[model samples]
Target: MRGWWQDLTDLVLPAECAGCGTPRTVLCPRCRAALAGGVPRRVRPVPEPPGLPAVYAAAAYADEVRAAVLAHKERGLISLAAPLGAALAGAVRAGLRGTAAGPPGTAGAPGGHGGGPAGGGRAPVLLVPVPSARQAVRARGHDPTRRIALAAAAGLRRGGVAARVLAVLRQRRGVSDQSGLGSRQRRENLTGALTTAPHGAALLRAGPVVLVDDLMTTGTSLAEAARAVTSAVYAARVREEMEAYRTGRSRKEGNPVYRASEMRRAYGAGHVICAAVVAASPDSVVENQELTKNVHRCR
Candidate 1:
């Protein structure tokens, strides 16, 4: 398999830190810390966007984290998933650590932030990925956001967090490529354009959900995902409450997405937000003028 080849090559390859490229190691110790560094802070994508659940970022959109994410996303270094997931897991734990700064109510919403019981033992956390357009996936040859979410879930599971990825989220309608758009245009492009797939919304009622995205810039993308997620959460809550009353059963075993204890109780954020952007375009990387000092010796 390709993954096996990559693993083998990793051993023989003269490597650089995926984060900072210190050389010789797939990842360096210091950069590893940087990737997982920082408390998960609540990031607001826009001023007028609806109330979004708390989001935890492992590292600021700077330095090493940016490089690692770019390597994984653009270059397709599939092997980097492990380290990225590990970093994401750490961020999630930090966000769960009391008082990270989010909307004031959610810490008070159904589950409260204090590691307390929602109603049953503890509310489960579901990691959801913001869907990418089919065309982009086709062009890139892989679903970047979905892939990262899977990696994060695996990391969380290994940590005994019992996390899972529910890929039921999808786009409601199509929008133009955001590449040429400014912040305002990007906002317009994504506005009201996302909707949950058939059972996606219903599943969230049972536990907490944290929507995951690879990167967050002006927050337009995240805001859209959050809106779609919230719609689903409320719908699921209403349906589950009604179903419980009608069926007189604790949970609908038929619907794994919405088992009583597993309904989405929290929504958070995770992104590989980066530094050193290009082209100054929507999501391009900029070249380092100073780094050229060593390379071409441009004066």
Candidate 2:
């Protein structure tokens, strides 16, 4: 009901820009440019979390960007998802340019999943949103990250990328509000707080997975989300191996032990996981300037 009302109002009512409150526009041209005009680049927190995947961000979380994110996430300006998602799509593309080919036999492999001639030379990229706390979602009446992820997937598709949103991650436990929390505190609060859904592993095999978020601050949430996803995928592989062994199909198919070893090696090499967000802290932008020296700017 609330969503419907908001949508109706957005269509009928005059509005101010979510980013800068310019009169009579959802997002004025200048604000839209500020949101997504610059090249997306790799960003890393100062004391980067141990398990955080390589993350790319479209813009720094400051000034207009900050205001827009807050308005969309906290104040329920749901119409803002389109622009935010477009920025996130650019970030995903940037991350993909830097990602190495997947290990052979995995979905990310050249001929596997959505890749190669069978897939029309386009590899599908899965956008797995970092889950929000249930209480927060309930209070806000919507899940901001997931909403943006859906929009991002649409934008990616329109841009000729085979992309789709996968809401596979879920909160397994409650967490304290992260407001005013230090980086260390944020990490501690989110550790072991997330898990993949029961069927998430199978769906994740669709293609290369990129965790998506609206914003990244301390990087704790993304790191934890990565840990949970990796754990689930590993567990699923083990289960498959065990089932194959029990059915005596291991020898007919391939050596289960060798296959498991190869999968473990791929996991250790870290080519399978990466992340992207609409924005990151200004400090990350400063740090990423040097990293972007050789990276081709996304047109």
Candidate 3:
């Protein structure tokens, strides 16, 4: 299989910069800087949707960033997961820190927060990777997002945070290609497409859930995923509320669904943070207005 050869060549192949073809380094410091500037800003796709948690993308999905993502996703550049996960780790840290400063959400509960240094009483955190469609995996012969999530979890643990990947998210439906679709179209395409890992509702409901994705264009995927997670959380919350009411207890406000609005507001206000190993400048948000004919577009 070409994939097998590619995988072997990737490891046996000598040093060459993924960014600028510089020898002796697959990813040079300058290029790495492009990724390590992991400031997780709230990114809003033009046609933002509802029920999506505040998502922090790790990088702009353009240029070298785009290439790097594609390299990992399509090419079997499995080695790239480390650096990519490193960027995600930074974004995750930012999200946890911001939430920690505020009131207690599921993230505030014990075992919810992840990957914080042991200097304080910071609890562990959870990393939930957005699931990939079966077709995509079959085509690529790998699960890129899941692989990256695992790497990110490892990186988080190394930093003294008890990081774990909740490999429970699953795609329940097939979506049309997202190349040419507008945000609205994208939204419709992905409705009810995901659910928590089998019986994972309980574990996810146990605390704050951060949904991780490799790229966020219109952010429809993230939004839809948040809805699924929220449904799981809300169902758990409602269950608890009913049980509490039956036992003379009370429930809390705000359901568990992650919303795109939350993430947009966070990015706008610098609250939730997202990072990608490689990304175009943040200015690329404008490209969402029309199908980017220059590169890959669903249309």
My TM-score estimates for the predictions, one after another, are 0.67, 0.86, 0.75
Q: Per-residue CA lDDT of candidate 2, range 157-244, in tens?
A: 7766677888989988889999899999999999999998889888876666789999899999999988887778777777887798
Model 1 lDDT vs. the true structure? 0.57
Model 3 per-residue lDDT tens digits across residues 176-205: 988888778888899998887777876764
Preferred candidate (lDDT higher): 1 or 3:
3
Query: Each prediction's Cα lDDT score?
Result: 0.57, 0.77, 0.60
Candidate 1: RMSD to truth: 9.1
Off by over 4 Å in 2: 1-3, 102-123, 251-262, 265-272, 285-299
- Scored against the true structure, residue 109 in model 1 reaches a CA lDDT of 31
Scored by TM-score, the top model is 2
Error of 1 at 120 (Å): 9.2
Local error of candidate 3 at residue 282 (angstroms): 3.7
